[model samples]
Target: MHEQDFEVDYLIMGAGACGMAFADSLVTNSKSTLAIVDRQHRPGGHWNSAYPFVRLHQPSAFYGVNSRALGSTLATRQG
Candidate 1:
């Protein structure tokens, strides 16, 4: 296998919710470069591995990146 080097101000260990949120905050507040590493093929961490019947312990609005809303505003307004 080939090895490579990377230059970044922040090296995030996972691509999970927290990691993604932190990355988003850094990107919005600074000009620092970042690298996110994850063992899984996708983001969302445990959320990806959870059973389909499983649900979030908290409201969906309480989750997700701070810069963006988790659900549609129109849907909330309608309901």
Candidate 2:
């Protein structure tokens, strides 16, 4: 196998909601480089494997990274 090297200030183990959120916060608050690693083909952790019909148990606003909203504000407002 070919050898590779990476240099980063932070190495996150997962690319799930929490991990992504943490990365977002770190990026917004600091100038550190980050490397996010995940086993799945995409991010979102378990959500990626969940059924398409599955829904969030709480408001969408409460489910994603701090810098962005998950869904329409009207949906959260109605709940």
Candidate 3:
């Protein structure tokens, strides 16, 4: 089989953040068909195995995609 064999608007290689976001945008803006495939069992890419110290280095509000807000919240230090 070749590229022409399968019919799809977008062939997403990985179901990572970028791929997922692209698919989401396509779904909301156009009627394109997407084929998302990932080596991992689920999405989130490296995040699935990210280091324990890895997190929103800044704030949650600035960590999410533009399409969806992370829900801005007032950060409070816990003793």
The list of candidate 2 runs beyond 4 A from truth reads 1-3, 54-57, 69-79
Deviation (Å) of 19 in candidate 3? 0.8
Worst 10 residues of 1 by lDDT: 70-79
lDDT of 3 by residue, 1-79 (tens): 5565577988999987788888888887888998999998987777777843564466666645645656456443432
Clashing pairs in 3: none
* lDDT (Cα) of model 3: 0.73
Cα RMSD (angstroms) for every candidate in the order listed: 4.8, 5.0, 6.8
How displaced is residue 57 in candidate 3, in Å?
Answer: 6.6
lDDT of 2 by residue, 32-52 (tens): 999999999887778878844
For lDDT, the strongest prediction is 2
Q: Could you give candidate 1's per-residue lDDT for residues 1-79 as a string of tens digits?
A: 9999989999999998899999999998899999999999977777878854555667767775656667555123322
- Candidates in order, TM-scores: namely 0.71, 0.70, 0.63
